[model samples]
Target: MARDRARLGGRRAAGLFAAGTAVALALATGGSLSQAGAATQSDAAAQTAVQAPKATHSQIQLLAINDFHGNLEPATGSGGKINDIPAGGAAYLATHLKELRAAAKAKGQDSVTVAAGDLIGASPLLSAAFHDEPTVEALSGMGLEAASVGNHEFDEGWHELLRMQTGGCLPDGDGQNNQNSCPDPKHPFEGAKYKYLSANVFFTNTQKTLFAPYTIKTFKDGKKVAFIGMTLENTPNIVTKSGVEGLTFKNEVATANALVPELKKKGVKSIVVLLHEGGFPADPKAYNSCPGISGPIVDINAGLDPEIDAIISGHTHQAYNCSLPDKAGKPRLVTSASSFGRLVTEVRLSIDNATGDVDRTNTLAQNQIVTQDVVQDPKTAKLIAKYKALVAPIEGKVIGHISTPSVVRTNDDSLESPLGNLIADAQLADPSVVSAGKAPVAAFMNPGGIRADLASNAGAVTFGQAFTVQPFNNFLVSMDMTGAQIKALLEQQFSGVNGPEAAKYKVLQVAGITYTWNPAAAAGSKVVAGSIKIGGQPLVDGTSYRIVTNNFLSDGGDGFPAFTTATNKVFGGLDIDAFANYLSAHDPYTPVATDRITLGS
Candidate 1:
């Protein structure tokens, strides 16, 4: 027989209370009556005589957020559906959490708020400029219980992450004393309050783990809930190789499953898996009434154990709420709140007395947008204001001007827009970058790094607008690659399950190079014959060429392993500073598409 799926609507709420009442009544009446009489009672009388079961415990509510990336202040959108709502800010998120906690309390429920990694790293100038310590402090104020480690968490290396976890104390870029935790310091990071979870990440040399594998929290109702945190297990492949050289990321499913018996032995029947990986459907742009039905969530949900009552996911930065059946055909709640603190996911679990397990029959999950429509939390607002003041000089300085509006949308294929091209060109032109013997003969920028669009009003481009375009302080790195290696790098850009469609991972924003590719051409032969060139010269297959890109790409982000094959790599300082200097040196600039890339007409 097909097991009944849990209904996730208002009816489910009614069913929960009704079921509790029915069970209570059955237990009450059966205890009061003689065994023979109780068995002989008419069905109608038995129903009436039975009393509702008084809930021995309250419901468990877990509130989760992910991929905040240290966006302390709210950001204005450049384009896309997200622009429809006001961008997320830490203050607004705090207000939303307060309201949710109050609402849950009104119903006699216990609630806890947590996160699924990328909470820091790839941050804006407000936080990144200060080594992301401000973001750590802000999250601490927001009461983040714990977060699964994401790839960006190791952007500056594991030791840096540890500093952010404890009070921030690290050497300056010059290897001098710049400990924010120093007494009477100019910039102190003495206020961090959250814990990081690392179930699978471990050190290679000492075999010592970075953080605790899992954390157990006991609720007011005496129910102990165990949360196991793990990333995609491919952390090393996506992050800079040096950042994770001493760590090993184990399998997510296997890691979480192994913890089950340990948690059970500790008498914790309710388990929640907070994995930092996510799912994406074949078409991310398609609007579906039921959003979570399609992506990686579907496969991960199906593979999870029945004993696991819920899974909180992240990394895709998409919002979804859905329930999938586990091995026992019991509904297991799986959810992911949108990125940048734009939304929060709520999971409600009801425990069954008979089995000492979560009654999957009554699990409820939903995601709510964090909007400015709600009142702001004063403390969170103050922290944002403080950081804004600290970074004001840098954030407000005029950088350059744009004559047209530039847009950045991931689902679209136009990665090399006028604005992205200009930024890449600026990095390649920096004197510090050019001084290197193999100055960037070509450059590539990841579309994902371009956060916003530049709005042109036939006038000056303000510093705020420029920073928004390329916020992360990624350094420019130059490397030497042969023509064949470049072709291999471009092949990673296709998107789909079978062919080039499965290669969406390879899209590049090019500078100083123009090329045409044919989709109809063979996979290995996608670059049309004699189409690629550097500086108007056809790229020689045997000759080496200089390439410029952010450290992330040089180290192979988005599955482009071919980049790591480059020789004579040189780190040319901060890419953002390079861009700023380039803009200052060449103000009043007008950028146009040079037709660097063209899909065969």
Candidate 2:
């Protein structure tokens, strides 16, 4: 670290040069990646670094973060802390990356910065208001080379995702979701300086992909390392339909395995997969421990070719380090950095000069907390100040207060969560829908839709804070469903039913209803008989009741197909609007009881 500081100024100058080149081109073409320019500034920076003297140690350092969710400023409340330590924010993240890069450089070790995905979408008001342009620019300014395209990347639809990758200003000027895009007409919204690789996401009926499937980086010594990036295969099911209309996602392992021979043909053996899917750590509090860790990544890793050297994952947003066995039964590194920029996974690779392959025995990984202990990166801080100033008036508005310190989605349990209950209740009480035709007697909110928690701001929350919790901008939807159909929706939350519960059991957060379910029972029969009640009255199979939910659910997102069978559909205002109104109206809202969801028979 000490040795690299002397030359930090030089690298900064080189980075500035690259940024200038990109900005000039963006301005020339109104923020589009011109046909003549095949690479981004990040790629230029990487290529420039390889011109340095060859490293004595054959080690390559990989610094990774995932699920950043556009947090340009330090988070507050429960989401801001990791194990009781103040963490996250783009400035601190940049500081950490520079420090790690500098330290590695001092050791003559080549290093690259990367992310798993969810770098944008479901962001705070500051970033989302600008269509996440600030996030793309911030990561680019700090030097992110590549990342997998997570489900959130498709939240706005195919064209938007492409625009995010290529670069362009949103045509509509301001007041988008109560925020402006391209705030300064003088400076257009340039896209990512980093590459977004999607090996599994492909164009329907075509061999091409939305973006390049993989990328290989060559170092000073002529040693090459290949990175294949991909999101989970079930991305279409989780994201809105329009976003993935003309695309198809292939199996992760198969897609990666098929690419191995091509990479080998190019003499690249040091392979790494940037996967946007992860597992839950048995000990969630301990960032480094991975004992009994289990999830979709485990199976995905096992199916990968043994030639693949390492795996960096995200999506579940929990951190852990483990040496999971590959196809050959030899242990290899698999890691994840918890979400919201709280942790960063550092993976060190020692390659064999003889075969240009990574030696599994020498591979080591660790998750570093992005503590507020370091000096915040000046460039990132300055950039954040720009957005913060513009977002001040709206973001600072006081919404309401809650008695509890937090109403968070941190605990994704089967029964219920305080945050989920609050959202469902808010949707059920939305005046926009209530005053239209018939009022919904019950409201359901998908746990996955709640991004952040309602942090208590000294018992007075701000709109900025509330915006982070539900940023999707999905409108409220009310429809009529038979009691029997409602029962089917409840059953779908478990496996062997019409859902993805085999991997993740999604218990719907409810309002104005109560029911019990047995986890041990067969999936189709998980819902306890005679337990469901609406308005303190026993549910009858033939009875009809109105239910309110988000538009995504009404479209049958997240495996609840029964939502699609409903009738008498009525749309209301945005979910965020309803939440803000509910908070303001309730003033000192107390968290609802968890009694609505019973654990067992």
The model with the greatest lDDT is: 2
Report the C-alpha displacement of residue 183, candidate 1, in angstroms.
Answer: 12
Give the best candidate by TM-score. Answer: 2
Report the backbone clash tally of model 1: 19
Clashes of 2: 0
Kindly provide the TM-score of model 2 when superposed on the true structure, using C-alpha atoms.
Answer: 0.84
**CA RMSD for every model?**
10.0, 12.1
Q: Which 10 successive residues of model 2 have the least lDDT summed?
A: 1-10
Q: What would the TM-scores of all predictions be?
A: 0.83, 0.84
How do the residues 1-601 of candidate 2 rate in per-residue lDDT, one tens digit apiece? 0000000001110111121223233334544322212332334554344423234337788899999988888777667888887889899889989988998899878898888988887788888877788999999999999999998888777788788888877655476557566887888877888999999999999999999999999986898999999999988778776568889999999999999999999989889999999998777775654556778888998999999988899999887765666677666677888888887787777677677788665555567888887888999999999988888888888989888887776543355888898899899999777645679999999888887778867888988778878888777888899999999989887854344435568888899999988877887898999999999998999999989998778877888888889988877788888999999999899986677888776
Query: Which clashing pairs does model 2 show?
Result: none
- Report how far off residue 465 is in candidate 2 (Å): 2.6
Off by over 4 Å in 1: 1-57, 78-83, 171-187, 205-207, 281-289, 405-415, 435-438, 455-458, 495-505
